[model samples]
Target: MPNIVTLAEAKLFIRVLDDDEDTTIETMIAAATDAVCDVAQAWDGTGEPPARLKLAILSRVAIMFDTRNSLEPGIGEDRLLLPLRTVEL
Candidate 1:
């Protein structure tokens, strides 16, 4: 599956330099994408993903990367889990 955000973009967001962790970063991106899709209840696996979704994914990836082995890596009050908007009739 194509990622909403590129590895380079994610790396830059997380302030990671060098290609040493490319594979790990890719995995993080995939996980983050899934998380965003799950929360948003959207994503057809094609087309440009929303900026908010991308930002949410990037934020998650950064948190995961920074707190790798911690027993409980806290993510407070995740705004990414906001309910999807609905059209009013």
Candidate 2:
């Protein structure tokens, strides 16, 4: 499956310059994309989602990558995406 945010984009966002964590980052990207899309109710998956959705996914990936092993909760993009969410009825 094609990702809205590419691996290169995510690595740059997370300041990961090396390929040592490509697998890990890729996993996070996929997970973040899914979580963001589900939250935004923007799972059309036809092609690149909206820009807002992409931003949300990128933010999510950054947060997850930065807070990988932290005990405290990290910030989220939920509020930013709440306005775009749709009722699932």
Candidate 3:
């Protein structure tokens, strides 16, 4: 099965995407999706995503990662998004 995504991995991914504005949204979504997928795959050592939550958080993951205002509604004050809480120094 897939492996669980760690905080380090997530932070590193956010860093990598910080440099590429064009692909940030897609990359972040893929990273989050891969993270969940990784966890699912490793859960049973089956190397596959769990079929239980197929269309889970992966759907809105892109929107949460979309820092470029690519979406119309734009990032809101929802607690569902982590980026909204990150404080820059």
How many clashing residue pairs appear in each of the predictions shown? 0, 0, 11
* lDDT of candidate 3 over 8-89, digit per residue (tens): 3444544543445535444545555554443333234344434332333343343455444443222331323332133446
Query: Highest lDDT, which number?
Result: 2
Tell me the TM-score of each prediction against the true structure. 0.75, 0.80, 0.30
lDDT comparison, 2 vs 3, better candidate: 2
* Top model number, TM-score: 2
Tell me which of candidates 1 and 3 scores higher on TM-score. Answer: 1
Report the C-alpha lDDT of model 2 over 1-89, residue by residue, as the tens digit. Answer: 35789999999888889999999889988888777766776456786577777788788788788888742323656666777688877
Of candidates 2 and 1, the better by lDDT: 2
lDDT of each: 0.72, 0.76, 0.40
Give lDDT tens digits, candidate 1, residues 1-89: 56688999999999988999999989888877776676666555577776777788888788889988642322641554454332346
Residue pairs in collision within model 1: none
RMSD of each: 3.9, 2.6, 12.2
Q: Which 10-residue window of candidate 1 scores lowest in summed lDDT?
A: 70-79
Scored by lDDT, model 1 comes in at 0.72
Candidate 1: segments with Cα more than 4 A from true spot: 43-46, 70-77, 83-89
